[model samples]
Target chain A: MILDLIQNSFDGLAMGASYALLAVGFTLVFGVLRRVNLSYGPAIMFGCYAATWVSFSFHSNIFLLLGIAVLGSVLAGTYVERLCFAPHHKGSAIAAMVASFALWMQFEEVVTLVMPKHLYDFPPMFDAEPLAIGPLSLRAEALVMLACALAICFALHRMLYRSRFGLALRAVTDAPVAAQLAGINVPRVLLLVFLLASAIGGLAGWLIVSTHTQVTPMLGMWSTLKGLLAMMIGGLGSLPGAVIGGLALGVLEAHSQWFLGPQARDLIAYLLLFVLLAWRPRWMTTSHG
Target chain B: MTALLEVRDLVTAYGKIEALKGVNLDVQQGSITCLLGPNGAGKTTLMMTIAGILRPRIGSIRFAGEEIAGRPPHAIVAGGAALVPENRLVFPNMTVLDNLHAGAYQRKDDFASDIERLFTRFPRLKERSTQLAGTLSGGEQQMLAVARALMSRPKLLLMDEPSLGLAPLVVEEIFRIITQLHQDGVSIFLVEQNAHMALKVAQHFYLMEQGKVTFSGTPGALAEDEVIRRAYLGSARA
Candidate 1:
């Protein structure tokens, strides 16, 4: 039983890493601007489609596909800002949220119209062989996803704390008015943030698509929802919280899958979410420390 | 040489009600100019207009021989003007260091030494560099606001009521800093309700009433008039 639990936990880690990346992306944009990017789900789905297409065209170098997907996300993010978010920045935040949701629906419909709803095979460059060491076994793809997630997190940490752009971003996020008085172009900073976050989302979509070896238009709705829940569970605007929340939810779902079947996995997630809501840290409940 | 800031026939309004009605003023280069007024006398509106936060309906603002009447706030800062807005508008969630860094947002050059200079000037800021501006006391936040504005190394510092809501001791400390900065050759455009403090610090003064400059003079002239005493000190002439 213990061995099974251990194996499940490792499998959970792989799932957790992908969710964590998505959570980080969502949290980064939401925490700074205080608006939900509903279109984020479609953006992720589009990223997966784009990554797979690039891999097929460019001869299956996983690294190249990942790079291409991230670039696609960045471009998509910029396009959203220019077309949807920027014009409404001064009007109403709710309007921006509605626009994002509208865009998401539009993109999903477009994708559905373009491609069939059925999942298509997408084989990546990574070997799918399971490595057994002692009494534990782990999939190579899962380990790769976990490593990439950790690396991205580390890079983000450095960017936020050590770089000039990070300093400007933090200033604007903390107080946009203050930042403006200090002469930082707030709109520009916000757009850059959108681009960076979407790129991260793209990378996450790539990771998940590669592992699952399939693509579907509805992939975004499920993953982005999980990311949002994880962000809320961890603490809104808390980067570390997003990661911890994602991992916990992933592990809980895995255990549920092991014991009560695949259908019970989402039920377990909601249960844990309820528990977290009930026992959320008092200081964190207010959000933003 | 022209004044550091020149405002001519400036008019600003909120929706329908005009706040500043065709006001004209010129702040001499490198001089500490004070604008005095009662509450709702359009002092803040004028400051906001000059700082490029508010666009006047009609006016020409010449800063250092260039027109900046309708320029954006960031552009104004880029042209060497920075404002320390009313009520100590420091970024509360951000640390003191971060707030100060935000101050230099327009400046693209290396700013490490400038930050160090600010720390040397305000040791308290250096002590609580990592502490959030919101957590600081009112006086400390005010100091942070001023320090943050200075981080831009602005040629003309537009301060809107820096002495509001503080203990007498803190008020005095703020005045001392103002004096020190003035001595260091920084041009100051001050708006305040504290008549006594404003009188002491100003080289040239403007008295705003009902959205117009009712009086403009040196400090000595304003102190000599009985009507001025009644209006400023709120005391009836003997």
Candidate 2:
């Protein structure tokens, strides 16, 4: 029982790390713009799809595929920003979100049109067997995922706190008018942050798809749901909180799936969100930005 | 002396509701100019318009002989005018030092000495330089706001409601700093609700009513006008 708990904990945390990366990207955009990009997951899916298509037509290295995934997501993100977020910035936030959802449909259809297959195989990160500790086993890919998430979080923290651009970004996040008066170009900051978040989402998507060694149309909705869930669980618009929330969610889901079942896993995860919303609405609703 | 900041026939609006209707105002070099008005009189609107945060529908804003009517806020700040916005909107999450750094974001020069100078001017900000702006007390936040704007190295400083919410002693301290800044040759265009405090420091006063300049005079003239005194120093003053 003890060994099982330890093993489950490690697997849960590894899964949580991926969710944390997704959450971080979501939180960055939300933090600065104070708007949800509903197309976030779809954008990532678009990149993964681009790579999958590339793989079918040509034999490219996995690392090159990863680059294509990130680039494609960023390009999709730029589309969403220009067509949705930019014009609606000073306008209604609901309008922007609705427009983003509309584009989410566009992304889904575009991917489906090019690649009608419901599922496709992707190049995996490694063919190595799971690494074993004395009593527990861990996937090498999971370790990479965990390490990348932590490293990205640390780098982001440093960039935000240590660099001039970060200072201006935080200033813009704090109060946009004051930032403008202080001579920070508020619009440029918004665009840069959105692109940065999109790129991060793309990287997360590449990692997840490689781990599963499979791709599906559902990846868009799945990535979006998981990212949104983790962001809310951590606390809205907090970097560190998003990561913690992601991990907590992963552990909770892992334990529930282990003890109860798969359906119970999703149910308990959502139930926690519902309870959190009901008990402390502020945590879920407040935009820390 | 030449005007450091000038506004001629400025008309600004929110949709069709004209907030500042053909207003004419100017701040002389090295003078503390105060704008007094009731809640809906558009005092803040005029300040925002002048600062380039809000564009004027029709008129001219010439700062230091440059036409800056339609320019962006950062360009205005870059051209040597900084607005210490209303209610002390400091970057609450950032440290005081970071907030100061944000002020100099437009400048390419080294502002180490300027930061040191601001610390000397607002000692409380120095004591809490590493602390977040949100954690500071109301007065300290106000000082930080002032210091943050000063980081831009403006010749003309536009301050809106600096004494809006603060203790009596803190207000006095703010006024003292304003007086000292004027003596140091920075032109100040001030918006104040405190007529009594404003009358003390301001050499020139403009009274705004329903988005137009109703009265422009000395402190004595401001006090002597029956309509102006009753409206400005009436229920709102208390």
Candidate 3:
């Protein structure tokens, strides 16, 4: 029982790390643009499919696959910004959100038509062998996923807090008009934000496919919803909050599945979300400026 | 002195309501030009228009002999023009140091020495360089706003109501900084409500009412007019 509990917690942490990446992407875009990119789900889905295509046609090297996925995500992100977000950015937030939703549906339809298959098996790039440490058995891939996620998070934190681009981004985030007066190009910063968020979303998608060893069209919607929920729980627009929220969500889902059953996992997670929303509506408010 | 900035027949509006009607003004090189107007006289609008935050419906603004009427705000700053915006709208969430850095966002050269110079000018900002601008006092925020604009190394600095909503001591400090900047060879275009303070530093003055320049003269000319003096310089001074 003790060993099973340890193993479940470890599994939960690995899953949580992936969720954290997605949530960070969601929060970062929302923070800068002040609008939710509903197409983020489709963007992640596109990344997974792109990585799959590259792996099958050429090589199955993990680093190369991840690179392809990031590149795909960046492209998709730029497309959404140009087509769905930028023109309407100065308009109502609802308009941008609605446009993103439309793009999301378009992406879903495109994927359905192109792939035709309901599910595709992702090629394994990491050893699936379990590593035992002091009676707690953990998969090597899961460990690698956790390490990768944490490393990405660290890198993002440093980029935001320590770099010149980061300072410009934060300046834009704080007061866009003031940023303009200060000689910062607000539009360029906004585009950079969308690209960064999309790249992170792609990384999360790659991790999810690598761990589950499968890809599906449905994964896009699922990941987006989970990421949004995690962002809300962590406090929207707060980076540290998103991380904690994602980890908390993963742990909660794992414990729920273990205690109740696999079927109750999503149900319990949503219920917790509902409770959090009810208890702290103010906490969920986005405070960008 | 050659005009550093020349504005001719500038018209700006907000949804059919004209705020500036065929306005004409000029800022001479190395001199302080003040625009004095009552509330709703479109002072802020003129400053914003020059800063490229607002597009004039019809006008030509020549700066350093180059026409720059419809350029974007960043381009205007790159052309060596900067606005110390009204209400001291500093990046509230950013550190004082970061705010200073952002002021020089367009410059490719190293700005470390410029920051040090600003620190020497406003010593209080240097002490709280790492603190967020939002956490600073109103006086400090205003100082940061001025310091931030200075970081661009602008040849022409436009100031709009730098003394608004500040204590008497703070207001004095702001005017002192204005005088110091003018002495340092930076041409200034100033919009101010305080006509008494305007008389101290302004080499040329324009009075606007109902979106038109109603009066233009030196401080002596303004002082000689009883109606203008009482209306603008305050009852105590008049």
Identify the candidate with maximal TM-score: 2
CA lDDT of A196 in candidate 1?
A: 86
**Docking model 1 quality class:** medium
lDDT of 2 by residue, B42-131 (tens): 988988888888888999999999999988888899999999989999999888999999999988899999999999988888899999
TM-score of model 1 (CA atoms) = 0.91
Which sections of candidate 2 miss by over 4 Å? A281-289, B220-238
| lDDT string, candidate 3, B131-157, tens digits | 989999999999999999999999999
Ranking by lDDT: 2, 3, 1
Minimum summed lDDT over a 10-residue window in model 1 chain B is located at: B229-238
Error of 3 at A193 (Å): 1.3
Q: Candidate 3's residue-wise lDDT over A71-126, tens digit each?
A: 98889889999988888756789988888889888878877887888988887757
Q: After best superposition, candidate 1 residue B220: deviation in angstroms?
A: 2.7
lDDT (tens digit, per residue) of candidate 1 on B75-136:
99999989999999898887898888778766779999988988998999999999988999
Highest-lDDT candidate: 2
Sorted into a CAPRI-style docking class, model 2 comes out as: medium
What local lDDT score does residue B177 receive in model 2, on the 0 to 100 scale?
A: 95
TM-score of chain B of 3: 0.95
Which of 1 and 3 is ahead in lDDT? Answer: 3
TM-score of 3: 0.94
